[model samples]
Target: MNIVRKLALSASMVALCCTAASAANLTVGFSQIGSESGWRAAETSVTKQEAEKRGVTLKFADAQQKQENQIKALRGFIAQGVDAILVAPVVATGWEEVLKEAKEAKIPVVLLDRGVDAPQDLYLTSVASDQVKEGRVAGEWLAKTVGSKDCRVVELQGTVGSTPAINRKKGFEEAIASSKNISIVRSQTGDFTRSKGKEVMEGFLKAENGGKNICAMYAHNDDMAVGAIQAIKDAGLKPGTDILVVSIDAVPDIFAAMMKGEANATVELTPNMAGPAFDALDAYLKSGKQPAKFIITESKLYTPADDPKGEYERRKGLGY
Candidate 1:
């Protein structure tokens, strides 16, 4: 071959090799539930950041809060033959079939921030906070703050059948079970939205003598707590003062509320689920090491006494 032709051929071969190497880098598909709240949005942002940090190509899909949409996304990910899949399921019970498909394709699936009711063999691992523990922490904080006072607590629950809603309710109930002085006088679903939470709290206030009878409020999440705080103010009552406010998911807005003394306490559900998930995936893929089926994240509690403003500042840029 001529020298010029050989040089051109070598350059083309190098370009092709580089392209193939880039393509061979780990590619993961992430099927996220829609940004239903600030926490969810933060999770999505953090997942993308984590993928970028690890040089993994991420194929993201938003399910818009629908199980059918999530199922469809999972199928598409399977068809794409991704190296792995991460899903923060919108609900738990309807994941068996899609998960089975992933399992059959030999793709390791990880559940992020939520879990499924499917067989453990279907997914590599689930990375999430202990929902019950989160609720229990909030309840325990409320109980300790009240300190034997007869407290009539109203609960603003999450979406009715969500695993977080159910487990958090159970944990709070368990925490306050021994405290006869602390009772949940009114418990209703808020659908995990601010508007619904405000609506539900308004009803609770009207039913309980215009918020005078309620001593405190326990929301399944901070978004609901923030909404209920507004409801308390509209009803001519102070939230942190008249009715001690406590909830889970320490999103930035809740920290702002705490800074304003509108919220008393919250349990943090960190949006760093993807960090742990990617770690596990890397370990498994690199060494064939099997991770535990359930990988529980930290459930940290935050009170107003904590640096609320600092917390808010720290989480503000996370797209919350």
Candidate 2:
């Protein structure tokens, strides 16, 4: 071919390749449960940051702690034809229909920080800490702390139907069962909110003879524990002194609380689940490979002794 004709053909091919590359940009839709707690906020922030780094277009929907809202949002994402969907479910139930819709649409869904009880093949992957393990850790710590001493504990649970609340309660009860001296006197749902945590704690205080018999408090998350601390103080008892407090989700606020002697211990549930979730999504999208059923992440127990100052500084950096 002539030089000019060859050049023109090459230019056309390059334009077509560029169009394909631009079309390859992934669009992800994320349905957040809500920003009810520090841990939830951190998860949102981290997920947004991760999406930005990956050049992914994230269509975010805030479910506002309602299952109906989440279902609506997921359907909307499916209708929009998003490449993938990530959801931090408010609760584990009532997800089958919407997830089936997404599956029928051939859109992969990733569950972050929470789980849904459905067919194993329903979701692409789940990235979360072992919530049951976190609860067991908290219970083990409490059992060791109050060894051989009859201690009346109150549980500030998460959202009533949420996986963390259910699994955490079960694991905690199992761990403390061997130690008959430790008993949970009051257990109520806090809805994973600071205000709810405080409100429920107040009721526990009143139920336990004006908070006099309450020996310790076990909260589902740090935000609730922090709120419970305020209630304990309001009831004229020195928290972390008169009644020890332990909880899950070691967000920055929890670390600060620990340093300030407001909280006793917390289990770390890292908010970086987005990375692994997206990694699975990438693999699934690239080669049509099916991902694992559950992607269990690691967790750690945090106490005052574990880099107290460093933990405080890290949490402070999180803008909590």
**Highest-TM-score candidate:** 1
The CA lDDT at 35 in model 1 is 87
Q: Score candidate 1 by TM-score against the native.
A: 0.82
Please provide, for model 2 over 103-148, each residue's C-alpha lDDT reduced to its tens digit, 9 standing for 90 to 100.
9999999999888888867888889898888899999999999889
Off by over 4 Å in 1: 1-25, 65-81, 91-101, 206-210
lDDT of 1 by residue, 94-117 (tens): 889888999999999999977778
lDDT of model 1 at position 311: 96
For model 1, the local distance difference test gives 0.88
Clashes of 2: 0
- Our model 1 lands, by Cα RMSD against the true structure, at 7.4
* lDDT of model 1 at position 214: 97
